[model samples]
Target: MKLRKINKQVWLTEVELDGYNVRGAVICGDKKVVVLDTLSHPRDMETLSTLIQGRALIIVYTHADWDHIWGTGGLIWEDARIIAHTACLERFNTDVPVTLHEKQLVEPARWNGVQLVPPNETFQDEFCLDLGSLTLRFYHLPGHTQDSIVVFLEQYGILFMGDTVETPFPCLEKQSPLFRWITRLQRWESDPGVKTVIPAHGDMGGRKIIQRNIAYLQDLSAGKDPGVFEPMTQFYRETHGANLGFALNASKSDAFKLDASKKNNP
Candidate 1:
């Protein structure tokens, strides 16, 4: 893991997972130190202690995807609060452990010290944490995954996009609400307060990143390709193919038009 202090109160950490890069952020507020996603392993988070000092700790999971939530053991103790969307918490009872077990079975040493830590506090659509000078507001964006969300630093004009938005294109899953996802991205793109968009797997940019994702999802929803993409890594190239398959199936679902009006699964 490589950590770079973004400012006096914010830090960015990046880790290589397989061939793709995953990112995590730390925001230090007057009252607490909040960590967003823990990256791929425990050692990836080992340096958090020095950055956190003795401040109260809070861990927020952008979603329960294994790569994003697996490193809690390195920085969390009994008192730390783990926060996420309610749907993310539910994943712990189902796919979360199953994924961990499967990876451990494949290579025990690599995933050995990782623990499955579920969020102790969860919300439905939106949640906010007041960090003195900054407020970390989380909203359910629900594109990459039902529990996926984006974080907004209201005071800093920065948005932390988990996997809801990516570099070349956004990946699609079987039950993704393409309509709702595009709608939400459109909303964010229009927000003047969202000056910087930082995604977990891509270069950080301004509103253009959000705009690009919106365009990709829009094309997918219309049953059209989202135009040619710049050359991406082998992982993303493979992901684009899978995204097309999922989008084809999603477009056939009755739920496509039923999106953006209500919470995806609720």
Candidate 2:
């Protein structure tokens, strides 16, 4: 893992594991050091631990996806507090173990010291913590996953969007409300404080990424294809197809119908 300092207090690291390029972040505040999602393996976090040694550590998982939380066991700090959205605990207990078992079948040696470590602190809608000079605000953003959360660094004007916003297009989770997702993206885009947006998988950008995502979602919601707007690699092409499928399926559901009714009536 190579660490690149984004600013004096913020650092970013990208790790390539098993063909997946995962990015993690570190924020060294006045009172505490925050570790933003851990990478794919216990071994991947070894360098991160060395960098933030001898500080009050707080680990925040963007979501309970296996690639993000697999390094939890590697963190040796006894005082470290793991935080995530409330639904992440359920994913850790159910989805994580199943994923681990399935992956172990293919490559057992890579996951040697990994263990299931669920978040000790969780919230439903939002959670804020003051790190003296900086404040971390976590908001529940459901487009990527039900447990997905984005962290906003109040002092730096940076928003860590997790998988809520990605390059080319955003991925969709089952039952994700199209209107709510687009509304949230628009909210972040319009925020004056949010000067930079960082997604979990891709290159970081400004508010334009959020606007692009909104356009794609809007197009899909209106029964139009968004593929012509942006060029996608083979990987994102498949992802786009899946996202379209999810949006189409979600639009027909009762939840979306009710949301549409409320919007139209209001």
Candidate 3:
């Protein structure tokens, strides 16, 4: 685990999970310290707890994916408030526990200490948190998952875009609202305020990253192969294949729902 500084207020921590880099972030504020995502396990949070001692702690789960929300134990001291989207909290009763059980069966020791912690606060559309020096504006962005969201810190011009946009491409699933996701990304792209873009997975950069992801999703919707001449690591190559399957599944689901709606209305 390594902690790198993004700015004076923000620090990023990352860990290697199956040849891929998964990241989390910490923002130190005058009134509170906000943890973006908890990474994979309790131990991943170990390296960051000391830097944010004493102040009121607030943990935000970008979503309930296993890689993003399993480390709450490391920073749960003073009645810390865990926050997420309403759909994110709903996932706790569903996929969250099932994912933990499946992983524990494979690596009992590695995941032995992990405990699932659901968010204490949730929002339907938008929410905001004030950190004294800066404020975090949260909006539900449902491209990656229904529970997925993006946080904008206006003071620093940083947008914490969970898994909604990733490098190379964003992953799609049957539940992924493909078109809705692209539209939301477009809104951020046109905004002059979004200077720094922080994603939970892959390389971090400016607004160009958002533009590239938008282009990939558009090509994907057209059924064009997103093949690049440059060499890709084995992990991304495999992920790209999986993404294709998921996109196809989502498209079918959308069509089926549309047909059902038309039949009922007619």
Candidate 4:
């Protein structure tokens, strides 16, 4: 419903994806176009692709998260090369047994009939795509997920951090190296060129979002009160209807009260 042009090459559109308001980006280059993430359902991307007909569009998945990459089969562009972190491809191949069952329950009606597609191309640390005048830098940031990565447009200073620090609910249960994740975020926070931050889940902001996420995790690491952690879980569940404690050994709490027991390992 809302659209914001970040730069000459970047356009942010807040679209209704699978009944949830999710953000997607279109990064324009002289010779090609780059799409940040996909929608929750196939029809959503089908609709998005129609709007972007007759353009050189390449799709990149920031991570292998269901919300961002589940609709890959919808956007049918022969020229659009799908790219993601190497680990993400592995994650995509091996579906978590529990999440497979959970996804069956919450996935949108449109996604019910579509076949899923995994990324064809994968990389480890760094990959550069030169779209004539614009250059995209994909860096591996293993925090939210060991497969999690951020897309940095060096020419524009835009960093598309996929689920790294968008929502209050942290999805580190699937993450392999937690400490490295923390370190990656801290280093990004101090990067002077990273002026714009685009998250796969929430509103796009500046470097402040990175700092806020770091603070929340640091508190959690220190064993802070459960009261402070309640909001994050509730916010994610309320928005996505996802159970935050799916695979993790964490407690669940209701948002109705600020009780002492309303905390979980978000």
Which candidate tops TM-score?
1
- Residue 199 accuracy (lDDT) in model 2: 87
User: Candidate 4, residue 179: CA error in Å?
Assistant: 1.7
lDDT for model 3, please. 0.84
Candidate 3: stretches off by over 4 Å: 255-266
Q: In order, what lDDT does every prediction score?
A: 0.88, 0.83, 0.84, 0.66
- Whose lDDT is higher: candidate 2's or candidate 4's? 2
Better of 1 and 4 by TM-score: 1
Clashing pairs in 3: none
Whole-model lDDT, model 1: 0.88
Candidate 3 residue lDDT tens string, 30-99: 8699998998988889877687877888999998899999888766644988899999999999999999
Cand. 4 TM to true fold = 0.77
Residue-level lDDT of model 2, residues 44-106, one tens digit each, is 778776667688899999998888888866777467899999999889768889999988887
Better of 1 and 2 by TM-score: 1
Residue 47, model 1: Cα distance from true site in angstroms:
0.9
